[model samples]
Target: MALAMTDASMTDATITLPAIAPRHARDGKLRRMLSRMAILVITMVLVVPVGLVALGSGAGVIALPYEMFELARRAPLLFPAHMIASALVLLLAPAVILTRRRPEFHRPLGRLLGLFVVIGGLTALPVAIISHSTPLARAGFFAQGLVWLYLLGAAYVAIRARDIPRHAHLMTAMVAVTTGAVWFRVITGTAIALRLPFEPVYAASAWLGWMLPLALVLSNPRAFARLLSR
Candidate 1:
């Protein structure tokens, strides 16, 4: 009778442990999926306006890339290079973030993204100051560029020091700053749609483009914490 009871207890323990294991695995996967969806949704929200503007430009609504070329025509060649790099960063950063599923591919793509962000931010500083129309706009863009560079540098240092959690959060922050390039266009487009005054709209966008994303991070620390923890 004693041996039979012990065997029954052992069987119950084995069955319960396996049941808990599957639930934990499922919970982990669900968390990862939710986090990925949130990041991608935020990314699309930022990119859609900029994408529409680009499509319109290509269709001759805004005047192609020529309109931008005209604005920075007198600026150094770096201005165009910066614009191109900005476009690449917008495309690559989200991809880097999403490629978490396949770390082998993620590694190469991540390097490409890091390279573009560094180049884009560095090139933007000069273009913003020398080529932008208003003093306020220039200052705003310059500050955004500085924040982008700083975040990317911090992320690199974190990874180098084997601080994975710090690296993850900083990279997310860097991506947020990169999206500022997109948000600038979106804000400008909204202002135009509203027929608001050009100067104020442009100036407001310069600061808001970058600040809003950081604000979101600060507001939802737990979501970001879980994402990096994973």
Candidate 2:
């Protein structure tokens, strides 16, 4: 779900053109390998600890870092239910990513992933609507849930029609939104760590977390139009 960008290394080596070309080629290939490895490492970091903490909080074995939600006091279990289901989405994301590379396993894992998405989205919608946050933040949060459900549904429709490319594009967009939870925490957590103003960052994260990723996925408007049209 969380894809790390490729890191290109710069060198100050003085060299002749004859040797430089081959060296650069080797460096390019190495960079690509490192990029893939970095993506996996980041995906793991996004999933494992965060997912476990959320899941543990729901189980009452760990404390939630934020203030008590009004929803929690009212229902006693609804907040935990939301967190646990969201945690499942994060934990299961990697398996879905990996299985996509394997044609035989892809459909089965996709079905499982879809099941969790529905549960997660269902649990999140109510919490988002009644969340104790600024109105703008709430709207952004609510939109995230709605868009998550919508894109995934679109993806399922695309695949059902045997439109592989459209399905892949839609799934890519859905994954971008799915990882917004991680991005939200990352943005706010960094702001907290830096002793920056929390309120603005928190509110901005609500939209930026999902929108930024989705924007990147759809950066080429014409290509994206074609993708959706298919």
Candidate 3:
């Protein structure tokens, strides 16, 4: 026979539900490592080709070549300068983010990343100015460059003022903008490979690439939050 508990009996009885298992610490670290590696891999695949094309297009340079060579041939200094610095910005942004907790490493890498950002932003102006593409495309890239420099400057001020949280957010946003270059190439490449219309794809990629990344980063940067914040 089952005995039903009275109200007094039930009040005196202790009830325990099953406890939820905590996530393992190593699992989190491994996830972070994997995420960082994925970013680096994407950076290598996209940015490296530009670097190679920029560096190796000279008569005797003898490097793995690509279409950006036209830029190398055209403006020579301006295009190549923008590309190389932009590549460095893409590469070092991750490194700087990853090294946030390690002041010893972060300082130097952050400085280097900032320098490249400045160079890349400055050079982008002329490249955007001289681009033969439609005015909309030129304006998009020019605005992107301006925004990049603005974010970099703002982040610098935040850090200088010891506003760690604001600095973290700004730097992450800046890094997202830096990664936009990679997204730009990816979208452009995919569109071309699919035989999509050129002008529309190219022009859209100019803004969409960065805007998409910037939106994603601002919305859910928790994946890299550990690295993004000290």
How close is every model to the real structure, measured as TM-score? 0.74, 0.78, 0.77
Winner by TM-score: 2
Model 3 gets an lDDT of: 0.76
TM-score of 2: 0.78
Q: Model 1: clashing residue pairs?
A: none
Q: All candidates' lDDT scores?
A: 0.77, 0.77, 0.76
Distance from true location, Cα of 131 in model 1, Å: 1.6
Candidate 3 C-alpha lDDT tens digits along 1-230: 12455754555553321221224556776777787777677666865565454434333265523545555566788876787788777656656866888899998999998998999899998888887778888888998899899989998999999997778888888877876777787888899899999899889889888888788878875655774432
Q: Give lDDT tens digits, candidate 2, residues 20-137.
A: 8999978866765675677578787875787888888777788655554455665566677877877877888777766766878877878887887787777677777777778888
TM-score for candidate 1 = 0.74
Choose 2 or 3, whichever is better by lDDT: 2
lDDT of 1 at 148: 89
The clash numbers for all candidates, in the given order, read 0, 0, 0
